[model samples]
Target: MLKKDSLLKGTIILAAAALVVRFLGLFQRIPLDYMLGSIGQAAFNSANTIYLLLLTIATGGIPLSISKMISTRYALGRPDEAKRIYQAALMFGAVTGLLLATAMFVLAPVYERLSRVPDSAVSLQAIAPALLLFPIIAMMRGYFQGRQIMAAGGISQIMEQILRLIGGIGLAFIVLGLGWGDKYGAAAVAFGSVLGSIGAFSVMMWFARKLKKQDRDEESAIATDKAAKPSSKLPFRTIYREIFRTSIAAVVTAMTVQFVYFFDQSFFMRLTSVFYNHDTAIKVLAEYTNRAMGIAGIPPILAIALGASIIPVISSAYALKNMEEVQRQSSLVMRIVFFTGVPVALLLTVASYSVTGLLFKSPSGYDTVALLTAGAIFQITMMISNSILYGLNKPKQPMYHTFIGLGLKVVCSLALAPFLGVYGLIIGSSICFIVITLLNVRTINKEINLNILGNKWFAYLAAIAVPALAGWGTEYLVLNLTDAWANKVSYFIAAAVTSVIVGGLYLIMLAALRVITPEDVRSFPGPLRKVLTLVLKPFYKRAA
Candidate 1:
């Protein structure tokens, strides 16, 4: 069993590592975006999406299944049975990984033609080999997680991402330098995934060997103990059934956003064709993926990571039919996600163009970027609510809600396209997640009456709005007074100054509005609590 404090600490360690990996990912993405400009980027991203989908299919459910089965066996004091389960899972991973890798390699051209991108075929094939080892690595990571060794999984992830960045960008740059076109360069970058998987596999192997020895030692001591009884054998067939059962449910519940974005990638070019020639359509698609979607994707991922850390408590409470505890956990999670999400969504929406300039070299789809970033709050809500639903054992409900939202999303995009252009797609994205969030919330209320904000919801809205308006006005003045958009350097300056101003004001609002009380601060991790305490002390004293 995990130590009492280990759960929260482990969650924080994993979440922090996940965030760090995401931050490091930006280095690879930014360079790749510049190297493969509008058209090249569109093609590469399409291939990348396919890769992600396949990856989701290959590894998403299996890891959790492994973790669950292993934890159950070990909890029953069955080390030998746990070892058998791990061995069985490893065999499954090996077989599944081989099949998925072959499928990706063989289907590259079919997907390329469907998506209508030339280099996508090559990119798909380039990244196909990554699936071979990744599923196994995922299994190992899950085993360690089940064993309560969170650092192993975290370390492996960081190692994977770092190697991926180095190999992907470095190879792409070298390819471009060798006078290969961007098309092939994109393929080189795609192959970096293979290197990343190898690096992750290496790290996991070391941990697995160490853990295997520990398991053997424990088993030997048990065998020699007079009081110990021999462990009962678990049938591999029964274990496989259990694994598949959990795996299917997990995959179905987890695919909400990935499907939504897949719809975007599928329909984006066709939608843009209503207003642009072929080349321009490709350019707009590039900007939509790399700028709008790219920047907007960060907040929700991080928010979900944070919100999801408390979920085991929800699961535990719900399993015991403790509705009161369930409500408390759900409401607290939603509030924490909401509080953190507001500032990020606000900042990104207010300075979308400046951020585009600062990060992506220039603002291509200014409205689209702003609208999409604003939509991130909805995305964050959707992600957290879906997770909550899962904890409540309503996995199928989120999947059903997701499909309904996606159907409406398609209709919304078609209806709004004439007036909104790419912003229509952005709005459609928001609407998809919004509808899902609302439906999820409704179901959650029916199940547990989740009142996240009580009567203070309005105050929360005000907290978000005041700072956003202030930030907007500040950016407007900066834009008009100085030609920030005319140069990237000036845009960076404007964004930096505006961020500081908005951040300061938002902190003050947090105190004045009593948004971040000492009680709320105390709930956080020790390091974060200390920093937040120091930063908000003067404000608290002023309020007192």
Candidate 2:
């Protein structure tokens, strides 16, 4: 059995690995935007949206349940049974993945027709082969995660992304430079997913070998204990039933948010195409959507990493009947997410043009991208809270919240798109997020028996908002003083520096007002505090 401390250490390592992967995503998008341009990006993003939806159906909730079941079984000293369960899951995943892939591949033309995207059929065709490969990859990822060897899974993610980053951009540029149309460029990018999946699978295979050796050693120990009692086998039927029972709920809960997004995209595509010419509107909407989504994508990656780590820790706390720890950690996670997200939303709102120019050099997407970036703050808050609810084993609550939000999004998209276009769609989505987040917060408080909306919540809101306004103000002053910087890199640097300065001022003011306790600061990991102290040392000394 793994000690609590050991599990915590593993979680930290996994979080670090996730952070690296997130950073890679940020950098990868830079090159992708450059190579794909706005139109190419639209095709790639559309393909990805479809791919993720399929992936959710293929492996989504099953992996989480697999991990939980395997970990619990292993903790109870049932290693052989756990291994058998892993093998069964692998087989199930393979069959499901292939069937889904085949169906999607065959229906690619149908989707293209429905989306009314003339050249996107080719891109969909190119992405078809990956469906066959990704299931096997996802199964291996789940197997490792079940064994609590999260590092291996994390490494596989990094390897997959690295390959995608290099292969997607490199191939797209080469194809486009060689006179290929945007369809070919999009196809080239789709092909990269296949290579990346293969690379990830290869790395996972090596990790599996190491696991095999460990299992061998474990088997020997089990043999020695066999004489003391007759070993019981969990029948394959029972195992399969158990796996499905646990996995389905997880899958639905995990995929709820993605499913909502997919539905929104499908609606957006159809609505926009209907209101405008097929080619002209699709092209414009695609660019607008990608730019908005690209800016919004950054913060979620971080939230996912943090939230994934938080889940198991929160789960273990619940398992151990440690309600205090559960409440503390949940609140802390919310506060941290709020602190990070609010300032980012404000910065993006204030400097949307600067950010868009710096990141993608596409001035056309500024308005919608700004709206989307602001929406991201609420989106991430909802995500974090929902994950916490999942960790608490109230998966259905999240589903309810998501359904409500999705309804709002669909209604707003349909009602607003005819007149408001992308901006209206964005506003509708943001409003939905805000509503969902508030509802989830209320549900979580009731479930956990904690007051989540008291002084702490109010203080964190003030802390974030005050600093965000200061940052916005500083940005305005700097831009006016320096003639808007003009250069992308220079503007990015100035905006980033200004945000930091303003955030610092906010933190100091909060500290002085005793909004956050010193113990709260002390609760952070030593290294994190050390870095914070280093950043704030000069100011502290001057105050002294």
On lDDT, the leading prediction is 1
List TM-score per model, in order. 0.92, 0.88
Among all windows of ten consecutive residues in candidate 2, which has the lowest summed lDDT?
1-10
Clashes of each: 0, 1
Candidate 2 Cα misplacement greater than 4 A, ranges: 1-5, 217-236, 273-280, 449-453, 456-470, 476-486, 525-528, 531-544
Which lDDT values do the candidates have, in the order given?
0.79, 0.71
**lDDT (tens digit, per residue) of candidate 1 on 1-544:** 2222278877877887878787877667677667876666776677677777767766776787788778887898776788888888888789988999999899889877776655778888888899899888888877888888888888889998898889988999898899988888888888888999999899898887787787677667764663565655678899889887777756755665666677677776666566767777777777777677778777876665765575688889999999998988788778777766767878888888788877876666767788888888898898888888888987778878878888898899888765666778778878998999999999999988886667776776777778888888887778777773467767777788778877778777777888768887787656667887898999999889
| CA displacement after TM-score superposition, residue 18 of candidate 1 (Å) | 0.9
Error of 1 at 436 (Å): 1.6
Name the regions of candidate 1 deviating beyond 4 angstroms. 1-5, 225-233, 414-419, 480-486, 514-544
* C-alpha lDDT (0 to 100) for residue 118 of candidate 2: 54
Candidate 2 TM-score versus the reference: 0.88
